[model samples]
Every structure is written in C-alpha cells, then in structure tokens.
Target: MATDELAGVQSVESVQSETTTKRYPVAPGVQLNVRSGPGTGYPVVKVLPTGVSVPINCQCPGTTVAGPYGTSNIWDNIANGQYVSDAYVRTGSDGYVAVRCG
Candidate 1:
C-alpha cells in the first residue's frame, strides 16, 4: 500500500478510539417511565428499574413542549449522537437502547 493510504488508515483508527461513549444505570426500584415521545404528555410507554445500563444515543435540548429538561437530556429513536433520553427504547423487559450510528 502507498504511504498516503497507510496514513489515512491510522488517522481513521485514532479518531474512532478518541471518541468514547457512556452508559447510565436506570434509577433503581423506580421503574423509569419510558415515554412514547420526548415529553411527559407523550405517555408512559413502559418502565424499568436501575442497573439497566442504557446506551446514550442522542440528545435534545429542552423545548416548551418538553418542559424542565436539561443537558444530557431527551433521547429518541432519532438523535444528534450525544446523550440519550428515555424515548430511545421500546418498552418491556430486555428492551434495548438505540445508538447513533454515523
């Protein structure tokens, strides 16, 4: 392979390694309300306890619709590839969280 090609591969590998993701343990015993939407009015789709580490898929800022929200906030099926919100997963046992791939 050419030297340029080798350099490109190394660059890509370094970038991928530098980017790290985080997980959070769902609040214990508190069956967190998985909303169908980002906000409360969206409806409680399901609930799960703590120790369930969900991947932080994407994050959205607080809007008038989803009041009292904050950073590392609202997550959804569609996300900006940062933090995750409760709406990013399906309801019920063994539900899996969504991850932003791209």
Candidate 2:
C-alpha cells in the first residue's frame, strides 16, 4: 500500500484525551505478536491474525524492526495495554504514528 494511504487515518487533535484509539490491520500472512510491554523482553500476551483490524489505543518506545512501515521503535497498544511493534504496523508515518502510551 502507498504511504499516503495510511495517512489521516485519524487526526490526533480530534480527540480530547491523551491517547486515541484507531483501527489498523495486521499485514497479510503476518501473525503479529502482542506483548505485555513495548519490547521483545516483554511476555507475549496474544497473537493477532492476518486480516484483522484492531483498535490501537496508543504507542510507546520499543525495539525497532523492519516491517511494512519500515524501521521504528514504536509499539502500538491494541488492548488491555498490550503492545506490538510499530515496525510491523502500516501506520502510514515512519515514526510515532499515535500518541505516546504512558
């Protein structure tokens, strides 16, 4: 997908909270591992399947990986404070695509 295709998924200022929830899909054939924290050192809490569009609440610093969105240390919070690297997420921006998860 084109880079701009992921742009404007949602505007950060549109929300009134410190963090916002937005939907993003798991890359095809990719089963994204959800972690308890922002890095590999954290426990794997869940595994997301391909074709699933989940609501990412926010993001936090983590290990960088070359994924569909290129390299980044950001991790997306899908639910229950679980994280998955933003590198694997096609979040449009090459950097922090969501508000930082505190």
Q: What lDDT score belongs to each candidate, Candidate 1 first? A: 0.46, 0.77
lDDT of 2 by residue, 1-102 (tens): 556655544444445344445677777788989899888899998898887877778888788777876777888888786888887777777767667777
Q: TM-scores of all models?
A: 0.41, 0.74
TM-score of 2: 0.74
Clash list (residue pairs), candidate 1: 58-83, 75-85
Top model number, TM-score: 2
**TM-score for predicted model 1 compared with the true structure:** 0.41
Per-candidate RMSD, Å: 9.6, 11.0
| Model 1 misplaced regions, further than 4 Å | 1-21, 63-102
In model 1, the Cα lDDT at residue 61 comes to 41
